[model samples]
Target: MLLDHFDYEKLLVPLNLFYDLHTGGPRRPIFHDVAATRPELLELDRNFSAIREEVLNVLPERASIPRYHELDAMQTYISGTVDKDRDWKVFPLNLMGVKPKGFADRCPRTVAILDTIPGLFEAFFSILEGGKSIPAHEGPYRGYLRYHLGLVVPEENPPSIRLKDQVYTWKEGESILFDDSWDHEVYNSCTQDRVILIVDIRRPMPQPFDAVNRAAQAIMKPIYGGQIARKLATMTPPATDGDAPAMAEEKQTDDKEKASEELAKKLPDQADPVQEWGQREATGKAPATAGHSAHGDKKPDAPE
Candidate 1:
């Protein structure tokens, strides 16, 4: 569809180009070095066991957890499988700023740990079934950085993610962040499941562009995020929230710029094929418009 292609060219691509100016141009290798920034989230690592148990609470119904494509059909090309039960899976905590009232409330500690992260965007548990591989691809947007904290890393033949030419393995309780726009993919060589806590936070930028990213998010969240929230609610009945349905029904009384934000989310599958940006998504460009409500005045909705 012309619209799908448009998602690549106009709606988001230009905003992505803006990232190069501050992020040291695209030539730099992927995977950011963040040992200094590590201390803040150490609590998440210290309490890793409890977080895993919280996730384990929902593991019995793994089949019911939404696969990447289930959340955003555009990902079918990369996420694969028509059944939705097999391959790479995701259980969103906060997607595109909308919290799933039931699913998120189940893991109080995990939510609390995640809430502390700065510039938080999307937060979720990424579960990869044994011997699965997510096709090689780049995240659709460049506005936010991606972080992964290993929760259940199988020791033998464990899962590893490929960012550019390097292949990095996840170790229990350790974490790392990287620019997702760089080409990347995942592989799980073992027969055991590999689960990691995945999140995206707004990338730091100089002045005006930083605000541009937020402005874009504010416009699109209501429009594009609703489609994602609604689809996810249906896939996992238990995760459904009353607010999810109303997302599609909410009135957008804001200005045209705000309405433009909705456009990005409305046909989000076309926005960016990879990444979730809600995966309306932890997906796409224009420096990723917005993830959730403002951080300073955070209403405590829980999309962190």
Candidate 2:
């Protein structure tokens, strides 16, 4: 039934320049009511206290746990210590449809609980230290909804997330599901650390498209296993507000310039525009002026 409802067109249409030219906003739907749509997530939400207790027990020794992006400068925004802090650490169970034995062993309970959720693609514990501010960026795709269950939120002014204009604050045991493909940013303004169980859940889609998305994820399992996500996250430039227009315009201009250059290379070196125009005119087949062109105004021909 879920597969029958999946709209592949929504996923495909966003890539169209025409769609972007007309609608500059995100093409993906955002902030759907998770409780109504995914009751399984609410069941998982009930386990927050248990998960948080486990996290607290492990916190003392989590100092050795590597930061999510140890080699990335972006971690500086999360921990200030680009080379040192392990603040934005992650404990991943499943990644891009691939389950790591060690990770599953480490978080057996969480892994067991998540295994029952057909919607889940990747499951992990996300740690954010105080004062962290993740800049605005969209996910690589809109194939999944990011689910966050607040495990341990700081008491002092909790950090808030801004998904476009809507701002949300996490409370322990509460959960939110959002389309990460939309431009979003996070700020942990609290004095203490914040911890959330982050789940990348494959968005429910129509039959064929759902199958296609699942197959695609299956194919990408090796990449996740190989830590390609880490490599890509560090390598790709961060997307921010206003970047869409600038990047699109630059790309369009570059494409036009390249096309013009290619066309010039194919044209005769000795060709003259004036001579060509004169030759066409002599043949009574002159090209129409800009205003009279097919794309412009269609003028009625003279009476025979």
Candidate 3:
């Protein structure tokens, strides 16, 4: 029903502001009926049960996994803990626009499960430990819907997420689908750890919007892929001997920053029309016109 009224033929102007404006479309429920729209997701849910056990076997060495903030500087502010090993750990299946071959090889089952779903963009297993809280924030883009399947939820008094004004909890074997563009915060107050398989799926929009979204994604792929490539290059270990963990980590950070700087150079900074309009409105200033000045043109000293 929600997909019926969109203008499938209407193509959006390919601009950042257009996406920002469209992101305010009506919010869906904090959770969706996974069974109704995509029963296949349930199959993914089942596969993750085994994957969860596998993840636990290596939980002690989760440090080997790259931290989220290390991968993307934009996330530094809301990543909760500033430690090298974050309270919120992420085993990324996909980062930027590419999948890490090493990660995929390590978790073939998880990747296979992800492959079953069409339109899935980024996928990862997120492990949130007790007492950590992900600060309230909105996603940078609106073209995707964030999905979470509770793979290993706390048994009692589990953690909960607050999206906008509504609060929702995760139930193992069930999933929640919501627009991450909405302000949201998460708290894992429970004593037990919480793990979930997270993904961002291309938003299902009508005709022109979908086409426009596809075009936007295509344009972004190369930019994101470039950044990912640099990071991967540094992430791969040297053949002769691995750098000390600390040295390797420091190098990784340097590479990420360099890549980010390069990506920034490639991306044009979009002027914010909203901010410009607000400033004009606040100052009540109008454009100056010839022969109509605040000083009344001084009347040439009364033609003296």
TM-score of the candidate numbered 1?
A: 0.71
Per-model CA lDDT versus the true structure: 0.67, 0.60, 0.61
By descending lDDT, how would the candidates be arranged? 1, 3, 2
lDDT agreement of model 1 with the native: 0.67
The positional error of residue 283 in candidate 3, measured at the CA in angstroms, is 74
| Per-model TM values vs. the true structure | 0.71, 0.62, 0.65
| lDDT: the better of candidates 1 and 2 | 1
| Candidate 2, position 49, lDDT | 54
- Tell me how many clashing residue pairs each candidate has: 20, 5, 2
Instruction: List CA RMSD, all candidates.
Output: 19.3, 27.5, 26.6
Candidate 3's C-alpha lDDT?
Answer: 0.61
* 263-288 per-residue lDDT for model 3 (tens digits): 55665484543343334422233321
Give residue 163's error in model 1 in angstroms.
0.7
Cα lDDT of model 2 by residue, 32-125, tens digit: 6676556677656666555665565445445545466653233345444432432677665677655644344555567778888885778877
Candidate 2 deviant stretches above 4 angstroms:
1-27, 71-86, 228-304
**Which of the two, 1 or 3, has more lDDT?**
1
Task: Evaluate residue 170 in candidate 2 and report its C-alpha lDDT on the 0 to 100 scale.
Answer: 75
